[model samples]
Target: MPPSRTSAAAQSANFSTISVTFLGTASAQPSSTRNHSSLALCFGGRGDTWLFDCGEATQQRVQKSDVKMGKIRKIFITHTHGDHIFGIAPLLAGCLNGAGGMIDGMVDSRMEPADPKELTTLEIYGPLGTRAFIRSALRLTHTRLDGRYVVHELRFPRDPPGGDYTTLPPHRCELPGKNLLQTPMDDVQWGKGIWNDVYADDLVTVSAAPIEHSVACVGYVVNEQPVPQKMDPSHYLPHIKRNKAPIAYLSRLQRGENITLDDGTELLGVPKRAGRKLVILGDTYDPSPIMPLAVGADLLIHEATNAYLPGIDPATNNDDTEEVVQARTTSRGHSTPQMAGRFARLIGARQLVLNHFSARYRGDDDVNEEAKTVMDAIKGLAEKEFCGEVVCARDFMTLHVSR
Candidate 1:
């Protein structure tokens, strides 16, 4: 059976800054230290959540973390690999159950004042095949959910191999006896791209763009929602406090408004420019074209699947006839920590976070240190390439991408 997938959503709140939480970081499979690749974006003081790449064990991961599935309103799946997907069905099922159950449990047993029935809805976006996959999974499980959500997927005529596109020499072709001299028709064909306007808020918007990978993949960008020009806060603060509703006052502050009370009290501290931006990349070796999409982002989360490991013979390459297929594994769309850092610097990312580590060096001993050594090396590759901070990720680690 094909694995399940869950996508990510974007949100904002008058109460807090927007943030994303990494739920899993392993790829293709789960390791003791990592699950698969998944992230949750929390927005809206309303607690709306967006999920990205729900791999297996995602439900458990969210359970262990502060992520509340009931808050997840959307999901974004990058690609359909077992380790990258597999968690969707169970999570959706669980979320649906939890939504109704939370209300039932609250009314019957707890003394909470708020009703749970008004919880947020959930939607999932992915490549073209997502709808079919989700339909099948839900059908097979004989389950129906009360909460409404949609899965968007990218479609391709043929399944592509894994990894990003590269300009391999004809001699390096995976095909036997094929040289670069061959006609363009002989070259591999890639899937077209897809762009979806997934989320919008009073002050920010989020969209997805198709990216090069073994198959059709996507990169996402979250930009601050467009807002009215800065208001003279000198005009708005005093009356807001007189309203006696801090939440209302804060909402007006975010919307860039100055309030006038009967006494003409003024508000201060409204944002001068737009909000911050963030870009999260999936597993692609050469994500060059998409760099501009990530430009000026406050934080960029890119995959660095290999870190500090000498070469390994994945033994999966068809080009083993060449004496050095071991070196070629890294060449085939897999990224090392150094490469992740190099790309981050190249894109002028404000912050570079390395994740999606290969299983080789994920051992208990010095995994974090080993990953850092490789990323730090990228600094030497491109002196002054990135002025941003570089971070090596750990499971359940959270970081705030501020404006």
Candidate 2:
């Protein structure tokens, strides 16, 4: 269990500050108001930006938002669909080419220009065909990245056999791209389903699991390390004032470290708080396979491409029943608001955020006479099933995940 908290980041507060920005929310086709599918999750005090799916016009969206392109360190691709990955090559190309072949000229998450010699390599993770798709696009377009990028390919039982131009085991050796790595995701060494430790840093960890979609798709679960509980000054301040003890004792206590004052005052360390977890999935008809990874997530970002609530929707079509609408959406390997809500309930998520909306239902920048009614119906459907907070995500919306 997480300890109670408030607004305070003591010196020991190296806690992950996870902020999620919906860069693009449109589904297969982008409307004038909404772009394609893309999400930016910024973590840590440095504001390291990690992207989930990069569609066409994503560069434009990033330029218009607060997300710094140079701060992008890792990109996690869901699948090889054009709409989900078209912007990768272009975005990476800009990062490498814009700085005269030196990425260090780019600003970091801290908004400070990195040292000229600090050339941290970029990483990209995705399903099987991701390597081929990106390699082909970059190679054919003659877009050479003077900097380094490693592509980590994931393998599933459903994936086809590996070969030339295929990202498979025993990868063909090539001149390492500027001493960068190119390899496959580690095998499923222990688990029956989940791919544990997909990616990890000092601040957080990411795990991957397969989701049911038309093509091979994977969902990611981000889990932050438990943060030290906030120190209750009332518990010690009065005592300190009475005793004239050193202030450094409080600092150590905040980090869950036991401390003893000069006069022999003993203070027990505060217990750590449970960290926040986020489960983000691509377009999917079902995602039961990720139950273990997603269950009890703090936030679940699921695709709700369509929704039809008989009494709430602004639909005039007499034949468009909830069943009909759901069938249509599921046929395309997508989910309705209620489906997303049901999954959220099954996973025991605390809150639900719905994205990857179809162009017809609009909000934020894209609004029509029926937009509010349609979007409300979508949220209503999800709330009806999940019994939790349901947000219909719009482009450029920012959400901070708190412990």
Candidate 3:
């Protein structure tokens, strides 16, 4: 559990900051040092928690961390890959059976029946077939998540000639000029629109764009709404002390409204701080289409599955040739470290966090020497190629994001 909040911490916790906890970071397969892909995004301090790509045993990982499973309000699945979504069933089951207490004969319950009002509704967004997947899992496992969770299946607009693109409500950004929609040949329904606005609320808005992958996949960008300006209490304290102004005036001033003093002088409210933006990509070989959405993002979390570091020769290490590595990664729809760097640079991300490493990069010992070496190479290449802070993500690592 996290430490009790101090007065200062409590003051700062009012949605002024966002933090991301890496629950898992391995790719395709789990390693001794890493699990599959899972990320927990906490916004506005403890306001809301969102999970991206809950891989197998992700709930167990959450149990091992300081994150509160009951606080997870949303889950975004990049795709239906086992490595990315196998944990959804168990996690949903756990959410429905909060505190692990028996609920009307349901096993895995530990506490009293959870109050419906206190239970956070879990909204899951994912690519096509996601609804069926969740339903089938619940049925097979006999897990009852009836009103506890909702699944949203996203589909691309059909091809342009065959179908037209229509603008959706709550536009977040300018549409990408280039044609990013996949064609019929891709084996899935193609959409005319380059991006889709999946979720939105007063606090944050989320959008998704298709990316090049072996199967239908999409990347998500989350942008927080600009915060309201903070009121400068010092400026009004003098007036309150001198004239005993009504305390109600303080509420008006905090809402960015001008307050009229007894002397007819007007006082303006201070503007609140700006919000932050974050982008997280699914398993993809090409990230070009999503660059528009990722532009000016404060943080970009992308996969670095292949070890084809630039300026390094794979043959010297007695491993597979560079050409072989590149071909395999490309064919498998995975990105090399250099590719991740290039995308971060192209999108002008402020910070780049590389994860989703292939299991082969797992170190011989617990020290993770091989992974560190690869991470160093990636950081070096990205420093030269991009002008952003580069970081290698590890399981259970937490990143604090602020403006």
Per-prediction TM-score: 0.67, 0.79, 0.76
Superposed by TM-score, candidate 1 places the C-alpha of residue 332 at a distance from the truth, in angstroms, of 3.8
Q: What is the model-wide C-alpha lDDT for candidate 3?
A: 0.71
Per-residue lDDT over 1-403 for candidate 2, one digit per residue giving the tens place of the 0 to 100 score: 1111123343235554788999999999998777889999997675678999999988888999999988897889998888899988788776554222212334333222355334446778888767777766665554445456667766776555553264422211112221112223343542336667667654577888888889988899988867787678889886677678777778777778876666787778888877899999998999887887788999999999887766655553679988998888899999999999999999899999999998876756345656766787788889889998898888999998877
Candidate 1's residue-wise lDDT over 79-175, tens digit each?
Answer: 7776777888778878765232222112332222266445334656676555546555665554545444454344333434231132222110011
Clashing residue pairs, backbone N/CA/C < 3 A, model 3: 15-44, 100-109, 100-110, 101-109, 101-110, 101-111, 102-109, 157-191, 229-271, 229-272
Q: Which candidate is the best by TM-score?
A: 2
Q: Which regions of candidate 1 fall more than 4 Å away from where they truly are? A: 1-15, 98-120, 154-196, 226-271, 308-331, 363-385
In model 1, which range of ten residues has the least summed lDDT?
171-180
Candidate number of the best lDDT: 2
Show the lowest summed lDDT stretch of 10 residues, model 2: 171-180
Candidates, ranked, lDDT? 2, 3, 1
